[model samples]
Every structure is written in structure tokens, then in C-alpha cells.
Target: METITNRTLNLHEAWFWHEEEDRLRCRLCAHNCLIAPDRSGICRVRKNIDGKLYSLNYGRLIAAHLDPIEKKPFNHFLPGTQSFSIATPGCNLACDWCQNWQISQADEVGSLTRIPEVDPKKVVQAALEFNAASIAYTYTEPVVFYEFARDTALLAREAGLKNIFVTNGLITPEANADLVTWLDAANVDIKAFDQDVYRKYMHGSLEPVLETCKALKAAGIWLEITTLLVPGVNDDPLQLQNLAQFIANDLGTDTPWHISRYYPQYKFDSPPTSLKGIEKAEHLARMAGLRYVYPGNTASSTQTVCPSCGKLLVDRDGYRTVLNELDDGRCPRCNTEIAGNWA
Candidate 1:
């Protein structure tokens, strides 16, 4: 095993793992990777160098921006607020259609060795400086950078900033045990329901993602779901039906589901999902007793309507909120309480 000659490499000792005889078993995520010496996990961010697992990308920010909470595509969670978004290199899931694959698949973009390191304190300071209501660990999977996310989240929470996880939701229960302590809300990208399809396309199982969603809900975190309906992959009628039912029955009917439009990216060449197909999926989800469903990346209006009186409560234009007709997070006209964490 090649030893890590560079001691300056951001080798923050990772949490949630133990050593075996030959390799270190990383319990950070569902993969539970047994990483050999000088090797990394499926994410390539957690490396087992000289017999210990270290988070290589800790506090290394690849992207940071002040974005609208709507851009996180979280229609239900603080709709009109700005979120301080940050992301490190690496992701556990290798979805072929990831738009941020250049950073998510950090190895593909370039060596992160040239990238400068950052500190969680600076992230919180910048979020406060920008007057962002929430700090989002996004772009790449936050679970891969769990240490950094948690560190920043703790500081952000203390500074009166909400913490949001825009994740694939494949984190292990051991890792998720800490989410509730700091995480205020999450938007889990439920790629697909078919286990075989998930394995072949994303190199992940479906059950773990589903379990993470349940755990987040049980922990009382505001949760939303997104599924980019890829034609010939996840847009099957039966699969969409099961997905809708799962959201309604398990995650609660008020859980906002984003039926997104798929565009070709990375290695996959599947044609973009049609607008009609997206509308159909939205219809199925609403029919399954889901109170809020929105079609994304299209011309569809992301306006929120009260489930009781059908009065429009919020109107959004792309990533900006044009109007919000909610009185203390309730419908102004109908007085129906909207399920969200506006406070």
C-alpha cells in the first residue's frame, strides 16, 4: 500500500468507521465500503491512507453561492428566502445524468489537489455576511463531506441560520443519526424506485434512499422530494405510481414532490423527458393524494395552491419569488395552514 507522502492533504479523520484486519470499513454511507490502504471509497473522497479513513475533501469548497431557496427546488421549505449554498468535491452516487458532474465527479473535472482548502467558520461568516436565511450543503452529495457539512451546520445553527441538505439521501443510519441535530430541512433526490435500474444506472440500491427519507421525516425535518423523469429509465407508469404512493403514504401527502424534466448529461444519452410525460407524472402523484406536486425545468408555473380552497399561495419565477400570499405560513384567503418551515 502506497503511503500518503503528503501530510498536508486535507486528511480530516472521518467519523462512523472502524478498522478490519486488512482494510477500514467506512460506515459513513449505505455502501459500507471496505477501503484498502491508499484507496478511497466509491465516492473517492474518503480515503483509507496508512490504515485510517480520512475525509479528503473536508472544508474544501468547490462551489459557494447565494441562491434562492426555490433554486434548491424546495417549493415548500421557506419559499421566498435566500440560501447560502456550498459544495465540496465528490459524490457517492455516479448518476449518469448529473448536471453538476464536473464537480460531483471531481476526478473527471481535475485533481482537487490544486484546489485550496476552506474552513467551516468562513462559510458561516459568509452566509451571515450575505444575509442568507439558510446554508445549503448541495451540488455534490453532502454525505460524502459529512464532517464539513456537520461542522458548518452547527455553527450556522448557532448563528441563527437554517441548514439544508440537498442530497441523494443514501446516507447510512449511523450518519443520519446526526442530521436532526443540525439539519433544518432536506430535499432528497429520489432518482428512481426500480432497484435494478438504480443499481445499473446509479450504482446504488433503492431501499437505502427510501429509508433515509423515512428517517428524515421521523426526525421532524422539513422534507421535499425530487425525481427527474428520464424517458425509458424512470418514467414508467407503474414505477411512477409506486413512487407517488410511497411519498403520500410514507412521507406524508404534504411532502412536496418535484416531477422534474430530464435532460441529457454525462454518459447517458436518453432523450429528455417530454413536457407531456412530466405533466402525466404530476397528475398521477396528485391523484395518489399528494397535496403538492410541481413540474420542474419547464414552462410550468411553480405556484403553490392551497389544498383546501385552491387559492394560489405562492408564485415563483424560475429561482425568484414574485408573490407570496401566505399569512404566517397559512393561506391568506382560506386560512389553510401550509406544511413548511417558514419560521
Candidate 2:
């Protein structure tokens, strides 16, 4: 993909804005940062300039790759297809355990020297040329680069390509309303079920993230939930049970829950999640009436079986997929309908 040189042309006016004296209140995410002139939001990308909120990271591509849709861990959406993954620097949330903190925490000073800028038009063209089924706004939070993702998504949609987000689920309802028009699927990281953990470790609130999940599902977006299991942090049995129950009751049992193993990163010094702990969390999720619970970030089976008949439908290992008993997304043996976009 070709990189752009002109920074002025890349500056995009943000979506949600409100004037507060000389400052502009950014309502794009739950933070609702009230930024002063020449100041940026908590995300360090959306800046207030001349009473207008502008996304500084717009069309700036810090990372781009062709990844398996399964790596996004959307076990139910476009199973084995390749997705054109792209991300810009900056994240709204400041998670202590951020694995991609190198890019997610990069600010104006670091970004200018480190990252390359790409045009939205070029992003769409690259996706089409790569023959990717979807374009994923990932690695860093997509909420910070909403304008760029939205513009690219519009063109990608026009070219018959799908859009996906691997996000932190901190997006506001107003932003999500506009996003759902082009977004096809998403894998949102729940982080933790405890409110205290969110406030102290993530520098955000839990309610907004939960609300985002509910809103996305209600908006007809194919939603999947991922929870990175960090040992002695969010691996409590009660917390795992509650998280699973919430997903089963609110998001439906058909919702795929990926319990991922968390490796120590950034400011977090906790030990890596054990395979035993992952298995335990997966077991709890299944016991809580979740139909498609998966253990990720480790060697494990990524198969989709019939909830009713227990027939293996899709057998997967890494990016390799084999359809065993699924006949048009239905169990061939029991004729039970499986919940997914199998076509």
C-alpha cells in the first residue's frame, strides 16, 4: 500500500462534537473528552483546533496485514476467510495490560516519527486487490480512528467487501449508530466483569462497555465477545461465571465467548494465564448455558458443534477449516440449525 505525505488533507472532522466555550467536547466515546484549543483528547488523537474537533490519526496506518478472520476470533462470522487488517495509533482506554501498547499508547510526538499515513481510498483499494472478504479496524482501538474507518468502510461496501472491528467496546451510541450501517461483524474484548478493575486498571468504566455490547447486538451487528484471562487478576471463578451468565442471558447463548490466555505486557507484571485456568473459564462459560465458548491464544480445538445434537459442524486448526457435518449451516445428522453466517 502507498503512503500519503500531505498531513493537512488527512485531517478529518470528528463525528460527535459540542462547543464548550473555547473547547470542544468529543462525544465519540464514553470518555466525552472536553478538549481545549490545540489540546487532544484522552485518546491523544482527537484534537481541538479553532473550536472544531478533528481526528489527528485519520487515514494514518500504523499496522496493516492480511489475517485470518478466525484470528479476529469471530468463530461464527466468515469462518475461514482472510481479512485485511489495519490500525492507527492511539486508544481511548489506558489498559495496564495492553498487549499492543507500543502503537495504542503512541501520541503525537511518537506517532509523527514512527507511523506512516495511508489514505482511506488506498485502504479500500488494497483490500480489494488482496481479495480479502473483510476490512478489519484492529490492533488499536477503532473508536479513535472512527472517521477514517467509516470513510474506508463506505468505499469497501461499495466494492462488495465487509467491514469488521476488533475493538475495546468503548464507542458511544451515536458513533455506533453510524458504524452499524457498514460494519458486518466485531469481536469486542470485555476485559473484566468487575467495575473496580475497569476503573483502576483500564482507566474507564464497565457500564459503557457493556452498553456498547448491548447496543451493537441490538443494531444487528454480528457480535463476538473475548475475555483475556490473566492469572490472579480476572480469573476468579465467580467473575467468570457472572461474565458467562451475562452473555448467555443478554447477548444470547449463540454468542461466541473466547476466553483468551493473557501474557504479561506493558505495565502489567502478572503471570501468564495457565491452560488449566483457560479450561476452567471455558467450562464455566459452557455451564452458564453458552453454546459456543472457545479457549484462545493456545493450542486448542476451534470447532463449532451443534448445540442441540452435539454434532461437529466446522473443524478448525489455526486458519485451516474443514466442514464435517454442516449442510448449509444446519446439522446434517439432526437437522438442527446452527447460528452463524455460514454462506
Candidate 3:
């Protein structure tokens, strides 16, 4: 048989172990998908071949775009800079309210669309071509395509390009440790702080995501958290307070938290989260000792204000950012060292 280089049975290395039933159990995330012979894991990318696991979607680039780093909800890292975003199909968790459901919830065989087969070298080249300061593995779970992302990140780092992973934060500790060596920054979707909410709505566990957040912070990666406030679901004030406190205590007060206003889409079309609700969440987050909390998905008054001098650090008018109070990563008014990278 001819070797299909572009679409190899690349399998996975960080998330599986051989089982007694001639199967491979994936431990990459909390799922622990048990794959039978010639079967694929729950993520739909990793497969068990002859009792060995491999990532089938390695280097299979399905989508690419140039987007502002702030769209990743990473306000404290690199504000208003552009990042080359890329992703392969397959996600570890099946969140019903996923915005990118078209790409994320594809079949295991991948017959949903005509996706381009791209290699790691090509991905790095695309980032350079687009003049992006970084490449973001987004749209779907980058962990499912670990080999491809790892290889591309190796080349991206060599090319003086940073790599960001926009993930669900459901990865195992070992997987996170293996990945943090390559990831420079991340915007993890916390989903919700409630375990039952996670289990019912996200079909995943909350503890692993929390653990991933702690591990990422420990690894010294630029960490950010985003929570889509769905009305009548995960939008309780107490739950939001718990989420904020968790970020303050575990992830630190410096960690930027983006409270995204959820709109009706996908499986849960209840209603969009009200702007009033969002503002209230921001208020609670500030009271919880979180230094930086921003509202997303609307043109609200969520400007980045300097905590020391009360000067507007970065004025953002619907993603068009104007850096007024920053002078090389420090607040110009108070000389307080800002937490983000200005250049």
C-alpha cells in the first residue's frame, strides 16, 4: 500500500494506553475514550490500529484565517495584534452551543467538506506569509490534532512566531505538560463552574478543565479565560461569583476573564444573554478580586482601565483598539507595569 503522507494514520501519542480487549484507551482528556480495533476515539481524530493509537487528522488543515488576538479574548497578552488562525476537524467535547459546529461536529470519516490537506511546514509558511505575529490553533480542539500542532509549533517557534491554543481546557495533566512546552499563550473556555452543568450541557467533566487552567498558569503561559453566559443556563449570579472567585484564587487576579454575551444558536436557542446580565457579571468579577474583566460580543463600556491611576489603558471600539496609556508594557500615567505585551 502506498503511504498516504498527507493523511497518515498519525494517531496520538499523549492520550492513550493499550487495553486488554485489544483496544486503546485515550487519556488525552477526561473522556478516556476506549477505542476498539480499527475504531476511532470520541474526538473522531485518534484511531486504534492494531492496538496502537494514531491521530488521523495530523496536518489536515481545514480552515485558516487572520484574526485579531483580542478575538481570542486574550486582552492581557497581545492587544490588537493579528494572529494566523488554523484548525483541523474533531473536538474532545461535544458542547451543544458550539459556534463552529459545522467544522467541529464532523463525522469520523471526514466526508462533511472538501478540506485542504496542509502540512506543518506549510502552516508555518502561511503564518509568515500573512505577517501574523502568531499562529492560533483554534475553531476546533487543537489537542485532538496534537502531532500536527506540535510539528507546526516547532517550526513556528523557529520562525519567531508564537503559538496559541484556543481550547476547551478539558485536557489531562500529562497532555497539558507535553503541550505547554510548545504553546505560548492560550484562551481556555471555562464553559461553567458547575460540575453538573458540564456533565449535562458539555458532555464532559469540569474538574479536568479546572486542572488544565492551573497547570497552564504553572507552566508560565499567558493564560486567559472566556465564559459564554447562556441565559437560563449557567447564568446564575452565584455561579458567576464562584467562577470569578476560582479565577481570582486559583488562576490569580491578573488573569484576564472575558464574559461573553451568549446568543441563541446551535442546540440551545433560549435567548441571548442580556447586556445588563453581562455588566452584572463584570461587577461581580471585580468584587471577587479579579483585576482584569472584559465584556465581549457587544460594544459595551468594557475598556481596559488602569487599576492604579484610573486611566483608560486601551480603548477598544468594537475590536479596533487604540493603545493610549501603555508605554512598552507599562501604564504611562502611573508607571504601573501592565500585564500585557505591547509590542
When sorted by TM-score, best at the front, the candidate numbers are: 1, 2, 3
Q: Backbone clash tally for model 3? A: 6
**Model 1's TM-score against the true structure:** 0.97
How well does each candidate superpose onto the true structure, as a TM-score? Answer: 0.97, 0.95, 0.93
Q: Over the stretch 1-343, how does candidate 1's per-residue lDDT look in tens digits?
A: 2244338575789999999998999998999999988788999888887787888888788899999999887888877889999999999999989889889997722556667888899999999999999999999999999999999999998999999999999999988987778898999999998999899999999999999999999999999999989999998999999999999999999999998898899998878889899989999998899998988899756888999999988888887889888899999887889999765
- The top-ranked prediction according to lDDT is 1
lDDT of 2 by residue, 72-163 (tens): 87888887788999998899999998999999998665574355568788998999899999999999999899988998999999998999
Give, for candidate 2, the lowest lDDT window spanning 10 residues. 1-10
Candidate 3 TM-score to native: 0.93
Worst 10 residues of 3 by lDDT: 1-10
lDDT of 3 at 3: 31
lDDT of 1: 0.89
In model 1, the Cα lDDT at residue 95 comes to 90
Higher TM-score: candidate 2 or 3?
Answer: 2
Query: Could you tell me how far off, in angstroms, the CA of residue 77 lies in candidate 1 after the best superposition?
Result: 1.5
